[model samples]
Target chain A: MARNRVGVIGGGQLARMMIPPAVELGIDLRVLEEAEGMSADLAATGVGDYRDLDTVLAFAETVDVVTFDHEHVPPAILRELVGRGIPVHPGPDALLYAQDKLQMRAKLSELGLPVPDWAAVESADELGVFLADHGGRAVVKTARGGYDGKGVRVVTEASGADDWFLALAEDGHGGALLVEELVDFRRELAQLVARRPSGEVAAWPVVETVQRDGVCAEVIAPAPGAAGRVAQASADIARRVAEGLGVTGVLAVELFETTDDRVLINELAMRPHNSGHWSIEGAVTGQFEQHLRAVLDLPLGSTAPREDWSVMVNILGGPAEGTLQDRYPAALAAHPEAKFHGYGKAPRPGRKVGHVTVGGDDLDDVVYRARAAAAFFEG
Target chain B: MARNRVGVIGGGQLARMMIPPAVELGIDLRVLEEAEGMSADLAATGVGDYRDLDTVLAFAETVDVVTFDHEHVPPAILRELVGRGIPVHPGPDALLYAQDKLQMRAKLSELGLPVPDWAAVESADELGVFLADHGGRAVVKTARGGYDGKGVRVVTEASGADDWFLALAEDGHGGALLVEELVDFRRELAQLVARRPSGEVAAWPVVETVQRDGVCAEVIAPAPGAAGRVAQASADIARRVAEGLGVTGVLAVELFETTDDRVLINELAMRPHNSGHWSIEGAVTGQFEQHLRAVLDLPLGSTAPREDWSVMVNILGGPAEGTLQDRYPAALAAHPEAKFHGYGKAPRPGRKVGHVTVGGDDLDDVVYRARAAAAFFEG
Candidate 1:
């Protein structure tokens, strides 16, 4: 029999978490990491630049299907893999929207999907016009290379983006910045969807996500008070986005729930995202496993929640001095029901080194347990 | 901050299943496999003789604690590891009972545990006397190196053991055979328990185990009709057995439910056993993760069931042709709620290759789904 091999580019927590499900399903998962001893060290078969065509081609030759741990892999590299007949999930055409925010905003607008009023601006003078039209405050972001609060800023004046304009001009290739009206969002939510190359798509329940300083801090599955209209709207919109963009594998659509109860698209991720982390322990089929099955074109598993509620909290920065292992005893003993996951990265301020998930019938207890378990790691 | 390394000394399906949990908990698990291309090929770091002291010593030096994928490792090698100050959970003192059935029966008797009537006979003449005393019928078993009904026999007359007696006598060292009066049991049960070196112990709800040709065929958690007294009896027995034997890791106590309403000890295993496989999807913390914690002396996690019912069906022999992966598409599509686990073993008649687990509020539906999913691979 032939081997069921799935290759992943870039090594991070998403790649690391994929190992367990791959092992369970008897899939041989290989990772082309950025460097040696990255988060997905166990499955990392080689270390090289994901952006290098030759390096990525060599790695792609060894596996049946090519996927990503992150969306930073260049379009040329992914296109090359597809050209050589190597299957790539979330193929380049769909990934373009995720790679460049301006493209995503434009595509969502074209699809008539609800989103914050946005525009693609090439200069500070254009941004000044948008900011002036939107009550003098707007969110400005780079078209590419942005995540976890980087490459983004809130500009109250046109001069606020002058420095970014200068940096964009310094580079050889010209790039446009994405500008948007400062949304009056009551809270943040995320909708996770997995689509197969065969055109089958599955959507998990909408989850409420909390951000601290533009970084994801916590997630609550099946967002409280989001049962009737809001949940249905997000699932419908995300599924359509997946189909309209011809995406394969998992797609994460970040959303904004306005104070007036409207749900709007916020951002997009073409691989396993932080908002679905709770599924590993809370759902019948986890995102990592579904991602593998989707890329491999096998039938997807159930996405039904195993409990009434599940709360996931990221272990940011880890311990101030010791390793994450040092705190296992204390944290585990205190919250025996909490599921702990560590990324095996060194302690750094605001770096996501691990996460904890707790599921139960009581939402408050689950949230508290997840928080208490995670607190032990951040000294 | 020290690396939490748990070394396993065998590389069968048991060791293979441990990989997922180790990965989830961030424990660096290394396996010393007996041969190449075993079920745990991914984690097998050293391919050598587990019976050879030097090979085991070299492997032992790299990890913080030592455990087993099977109970076949010699006691001397385990004690040597302890002498060298390396931790060996279910250390030599406890593993002896599991390795030798006669020793286990004697110890359980000494502890006032409920067990079938049994005696050790060194020759066929002694066997005759025992058979004459026990209703002219008895079950004879070779105490050492026996598993999966390989060294067990049922006899209506003493001469059924004549061949075994000759084989035992041909060897340089004479060995005794254990003889027992076959209990008229109605069903089989198993109790799974995990204990840390610090004396903390936790047991899952007793489960009903079904056997076919002496191989585990299926398991149902919280065994039906065993909620009150029977459940308490089994948990009490298994915990006492773990504490009595000075066991550090997981212990599986296979029990028999007599027609007259009594639970009797049937067998004992010192590591993760097939009966508890349902815990992977049914319980809050699976047995593999708990075993790593128990062996490492870290606090044990919760054993609470995540659902009301869970049924696990073993896929023996896998497909008649092709690999287990070949059948995944059809099986997964038919039973999307079922969880499939493959051990990476080739298809062979009566060999355990994989399993399927289904958990829900209804027992009959869970059982049907588990069986239907497993059926997809048997052909």
Candidate 2:
């Protein structure tokens, strides 16, 4: 049989994790990394900028299907690939919602999904009107190019966004901002789902994501204390989002778990997200593997939990302590059951260089093990 | 911390499987493959004949620790590297036992471990004596360089071995043959263990390996009907062998489960063996990962079974059918829970090109699913 060649347009950690599964399935993966020595360099890779249409098309020429490691590929480039008959999963139409916050908010709202009260704001005056109508406090965001708490800010008054508003007007950018009322909630959670071109969909357990300074720190699978209705609701919402957007890959819907027992859409990531990293060791089928299957239009794998509880703690790089390898001997011996994964990247302060996952029948024990193993890397 | 650079001396599927774990542990792996584009070619590989001292030594100089994907590395070459202060786990002293059948037999017998009755044979007369003591039938094996049923034969009479004895006498090969009484066993089993230089040992459940035409075709973990004393006996035997030989790596001890319930030692392999491939998806720590840990002298991962039953079925290539990749679309669609792995090798009849693993609470279901998925590739 001919091998299915899948071209990935970004060579970050997400693409790195996808290699094992692609190898397992006998698929040839060709990656266009941003540089010569990126995370997914282990695979057959070509170094080129995805924003350069000719560079991306050259990389796409070697593969049967195309997907993304990040959603930064410009819409025009993606549409051009589709127009030229290259099968890009989560096609331009679906990926545009992930690239532009305003588009995503408008689309999800139109789908009757429960999203925070929000609107597109062109200037500080428009933001002021929306903030006053709510509670004089709002969360303001640039419509594009935001991640890991960047390009986002919470402002109590319109004046707080003057700098951003001026910059947008100076660049002749119209309606370049998305604003929403400040969400007061108990905690944050993430629901991950995978959909294929054949309309097959699978959802993993909803996970509670603990955020520190807007960066995901830890994730507890199935969201402790969220059995029955809450878990079901999260899964249903994620499934709807996947189906609504025609997302032919993994879709991660970050949600606000309001104290009043409501779940509202907060953000969307149309690729394997950090919240589902626990699935690599804790679930029957990991998000990376499922994403590949979905994009290839192969049948999706089971999403059942492998244990009663699973926890994943991110190993945020610390101030140039030592290489992660130096910490391996102790961390490995300390928790033999914890599964650690390093992204093969140089460490930098607060960067996610690796993660640890632990699964068992005891929730507290797994959580502690995952956290302790991650802490060892942080040093 | 600095990353540990490991140099693997062979580039078959065993080494291919080690790359994922090495990447996860933040270690760099360098492989000396026998040929260009062999399995494990994706990793940083140098193509050269490992038997050449200069070639092997050149590859050795680039890494911190040296290990093997196959046991064919000459002991003298290993010793030469060790003499130069390069750490070679399963150092030449320990590797010698695996390299020569007679050496392994003598050592295990001296250790008082249960082994088949055997003796060295240099001539037809010696073979006759061995046969006479064992109902005139015995198994004869070449002392070195035998694998996968090669260099082995069944003899009932002196004349049946005349040609071999003549060759040995002409070559002045002293005691070049190992003979053993034909075993009267109901089935074959394998016990896998990993040991580190730090002296930590971990054993996985004994597994029943099914052989077809003298090649391993399937493996069932926690061998059905094997528990309590029988299971403990197998694990203990494997553990004793690893420690006794000072084998600092993953060791596979093949055994004959006698009809009367005793387990006898049959053969040994000092690297990741096919019998333990089920561990990739079935056990908490896969043999490939454990092998790397053991060789690096790092603390090993847990060897606990993740499911009640796990089955692995080898996908042997058939008569010039299609590539394994051709069958993936159907096989994967039919069995979503089965984990498939391909070695990226060009297929030849009866060659083990890939394998499928499935684990669940029910043994019958998991076994059937694994077999069905494997059969798809065979076609």
lDDT of 2 by residue, A1-379 (tens): 4537888989899999888777666677788999987888888469988999999999888898999999999999999999999999999999999999999999999899999999988777898999999889999999988999998999998888888888887888545689998899999999999999989999998999999888999999989988888888988999999988888899999999998899999999999999999998788899998998888888789898988999999988742676788788888999899898888888998898999999899888888888888888775
- Per-residue lDDT tens digits for candidate 1, residues B1-379, read 5649999999999999999989888889999999998999888889999999999999999899999999999999899999999989989999999999999999999999999999999887899999999899999999898888789999988788988888888986778899998999999999999999999999999999999999999999989999999999999999999999998899999999999999999999999999999999899889999999999888999999988999999999989999999998889899889999999899999999999999988898888888999999997
Leading candidate by lDDT:
1
Estimate, for each residue in A1-379, the C-alpha lDDT of model 1 and write its tens digit. 5549999998998999999999998899999999998989889988999989999999999999999999988999899889999999989999999998888888889999999999888898898899889999999999999999998899999888888888889996778899998999999999999999999899999999999999999999989999889999999999999998888999999999999989999999989999999999889999999999999999999999988999999999999998898998899899999999988888899999999999988999888888988999997
Q: Which residue pairs show backbone clashes in model 2?
A: A1-B323, A1-B326, A322-B1, A323-B1
Fraction of true contacts retained by every candidate, in order, equals 0.78, 0.72
Best by DockQ: 1
Q: What would the per-residue lDDT of candidate 2 be over residues B172-271, giving only the tens digit for each residue?
A: 7545689998899999999999999879999999999999988899999988888888799999999999999999999999999988878999999999
- TM-score between candidate 1 and the true structure: 0.99
lDDT of 1 at A47: 94
> For residue A98, what is the lDDT in candidate 1?
92
Give candidate 2 regions above 4 Å deviation: A1-3, B1-3, B169-175, B318-320
Q: Relative to the unseen true structure, what is the C-alpha lDDT of residue A230 in candidate 1, on a scale of 0 to 100?
A: 97
